[model samples]
Target: MNTQQRTSTLQHSGVNEAEVSKLFRNTYSLLAMTLTFSALVAFGSMTFNLPHPGIIIMLVGFYGLLFLTTKLRNSPWGLVSTFAFTGFLGYTLGPILNMYLSLPNGGSLVTMALGMTALVFFSLSAYAILTRKDFSFLSGFIMAGFVVLLCAVVASFFIEISGLQMAISAGFVLFSSAVILYQTSSIIHGGEDNYIMATITLFVSIYNLFLSLLHLLGIFGGDD
Candidate 1:
């Protein structure tokens, strides 16, 4: 390449790197804030002994807020929608946590689940970021996995089968972990440039992973 061409190529590379870095930083920062806000809301719900909203209300609220977030992703209102989504999920979680906390050794089980979720998320994300491997190949698998899981969840409402529930939990753990890796790789590889959307994806994955771990722990960790 000629000298001028080489310099131009170098400048383009630098700009690309800077943009990626900024996207990564903004995504993580927003994620941290949303997580903290969710936690506080959850604590408040638990402290006040809030009733668990029924499945209908919870689903409506979650999907509605999520839709709003998607529509507003490019605008400042996206932040509000994001928090609304996370906080609603957190509120739902508070009652679930209360149920578990009523069981024997429930406190320890919850703690263990939380620790495992954090460990899995950070480890997978770090591996993806440091290696910058293209996990795009897993995209199809991840989507298929979610579809199967969604079917399982729907069936669970009717079947009342313990084994099926366990399977669903295990599936979530694997798929959610894959999502963390895939989503982080997407961010660094320029597939995902919107920090708001990225935060939503990562936060949902973490939330699902934690719930799955908690369910598995409750089943195996001597709830009775």
Candidate 2:
């Protein structure tokens, strides 16, 4: 909905800033549901001891489903595609989680990472919405950082640096947090109207953030 529509709805229906407000409300609602669904799928994957698809296949599945969701964004199929994409990604985490779970402090590490992710996301998002800061300027920088990180990851396959993995994980923590802020800002400013896409963006950010934190914790504080 546009600004005029929001004003009209507010005046007519007594709903405060209906268009933007409704958009924010819907986006968050869908994000919450999708995150829950992703969590359940991840848990199921771990419970069943599902094998990880590895990085190559994992990327293919994620990008492919992501494409599908983008194409189907205007229909009910979009929601289906969103869940499929998230669930697939969640399933891929099973093996990684399993590896961590085998560590002496695995459970605590996972819990700590999760707690940190939650804290960071909520803090950043609330800051954006409450302060109404425009983070749109970070768009180019975030994209560039993402490309650099992706290249670093791909390069890791052939070049084994002593601290490369840790560095990548560290980069991701900041990258994902920036994404959360950027996406939230987009929603607040009405640059994004589609909740499905918004949900995916934030979900991916949180997912990566958790994994990065887990990796960092494992390296620094986990079992020797």
What are the Cα lDDT values of the candidates?
0.94, 0.89
lDDT of 1: 0.94
159-215 per-residue lDDT for model 2 (tens digits) = 989999999999999999999999999987878888888889999999999999999
lDDT, model 1, position 49: 90
TM-score of 1: 0.97
Clashing pairs in 1: none
User: Model 1, range 67-129, lDDT digits (tens) per residue?
Assistant: 999999999999999999999998998999999999979999999999999999999998998
Q: What is the TM-score of each candidate against the true structure?
A: 0.97, 0.91
Count clashes in each candidate, considering only residues at least 3 apart in sequence or on different chains: 0, 0
The runs of at least 3 residues in candidate 2 whose Cα sits more than 4 Å from the true structure, single-residue gaps closed, are 1-16, 222-224
Model 1 scores worst on lDDT over the 10 consecutive residues at: 215-224
Off by over 4 Å in 1: none
Quote the lDDT for 110 in model 2. 90
Candidate 2 whole-model C-alpha lDDT, 0 to 1? 0.89
